[model samples]
Target: MSLLISFSHLISRTFLLDFLYLFSVQIAQQVKLNKEFFSLDPATGLDGKIYGLPLYGGTDALFYNPKLFEEAGLDPNKPPKTWAELQEYAKKLTKPEKGQYGMGIYGKTVHAVRIMHYMSNAGANGDILRLNRKKNNSWDILVNSPASLKAWQYLRKFVDDKSIPPNTVELTYPDLISLFAQGKVAMLTTGPWGIATIKAANPNIEFRVALHPTPDGKPPKLRTAPLITVISKRSKNPNEAYTFLKYLTIQIGAEMAGKGYGVLTQTAANTPQVKNNPMMKVFADQQKYAYFSAQELLLAEWLKCKDQAWGPAWEGMLMGSVSPKEAVNQAAKRIKEILGDKGNLIYPVK
Candidate 1:
């Protein structure tokens, strides 16, 4: 009877311990990051609990490798103001035989992503895959404009000079970021994801993130890919999601910019931390200058012609590919093909 009592007491204690541990874990999981706000999110269609907010925390300013610029006798504080200047700086930064590159950018990729974010600022419109696909595909506001052609022509100088690695042809997003972080490339235009990783990988590197240089003596009309928090249609706790998202985005989550995590597209400018930090300030000020890329059925098709026709077309024309008129015409012709593929014919030349 004494042994039986002792054994029973041991079992009871063990069971209690196990139950407590499991309960603790459940609490931890439930409280993960933004989980607490779900109760307030708009599931019951309650306006008191809900508000409208545009997308936020989607991008950051990009910069050049400052140490490399210094070595090349360039001032890191002053980046190139225009495409002509950037190309020139790249030429100075290039040191090929030892496997150094001047600029690390998307070179010859499909889906036309680079021009979508950075190209439009030069008064371009590079979103060719799905124009007006989102609320802000303003990327193609000026796809048919002369400035659009000039932006492309400027890009070819890097190609013309072979400033990037030959493998740039096969480079993807990860490849480019990795190469840039290693100081293999002199300049790169990117946002927080690259900043977050690069800081982790090469924290001490002489680099600073800044606005992507514009070709026309100003910043490009800014547009960045935004990371959004949306309530899932199928979520059992959609109200939970809205509650969580509102608190995350509007309250606690807005702190991401301070921690160098999220971009805070909506209140970035107003945030004390964002306003105070010089690095974060660039983005906030640059925000005023940004507008999204083209948006419409078949906008992407027109963007390609703007890109392909401009760079080689305009550069070659300036360097001699065909006359500007001929080049523009050729670009228009190519756009027709891309449009036709999507069953959304843009050029009526057919």
Candidate 2:
């Protein structure tokens, strides 16, 4: 019953621990982390050294009501592949007169980050943010770019057209899940965790998870959030802790995958339970294109901007206080102020 290991969320915060710098180097000299999608995640390792292991990850996917689709005259088996098709599907499925909206979007508040990132999958590269590798790897705010504007404009269309539920303005993930489960909304963006929650809430509902629709009819490059487990720098037994972590991530991880948890290693994902599970298969397939947020590595300062600046900007757009362009531009201004001279601008400053 000794405390050999401690599990912590948000491995990014490990950057704040002074002793972890030394601990990371020690771990790198001894072992390697589980390496599935490691290349795609810029946040891997602490300051160019191995530190923690990604235990689980979450990527947003479209969950739709097959009954609603059939009712709307759309094929229940085939989900929308493009943004245009999604819109048409929403329009056909919407029954505002009957108190049902076709889609559930978190228009305003901090959840806007998820919605905006989902839009990025539809071709909003470098919009909200992107790494400027050419400029010493500085973070660039791309809110005012054409790609960003197009994405937000589409969201505005959904808001203006009433395709999204009336309660969507400040909707969090739980709210959207509840709405979808209660049959108030037909479509939503959620991760694999949502499937079980939806079933628990409404077992009779027929729903399926699909890749989020893109604007160009191609597979979208969506953002992924991973649950990483880091070893404590002040651990009493660092070696034992590492051994336990390695086992958890590589061995037990497979077992967890079958139960619908995101695993860090490919071998874990290849387990019969995971491979056979339908919903997990969709998430596994999408892992190839998943990328982590830069904010994951930047931690506190970036998160501050997300909450204080970006959230309000998106809220303004959703509430009709500003146009899409104005909302995004305002966000960019606030972010630039937060980063100040620290970040290099890839997009031209307006």
Which candidate number maximizes lDDT?
2
TM-score of 1: 0.63
Stretches of candidate 1 off by over 4 Å are 1-55, 108-111, 124-145, 229-245, 270-273, 294-350
Candidate 1 local lDDT, 1-350, one digit each (tens)? 00001111222242532322222112122334322221222211111222222234444466778889898999988888777787888888899876789887654443344554544654433333233323332222233345545555566567779886766655767787778878898887766556667777777776776776765667656554333333433446645655565565666655776666544445545578777776667766565555432221113333345456434444344344465445544554555554454323232321
On the 0 to 100 scale, the lDDT of residue 133 in model 1 is 27
lDDT of each: 0.52, 0.70
Every model's TM-score = 0.63, 0.86
Q: Which candidate wins on TM-score?
A: 2
> Candidate 2 — number of clashing residue pairs?
1
Off by over 4 Å in 2: 1-23, 26-50, 122-124, 131-137, 232-240, 348-350
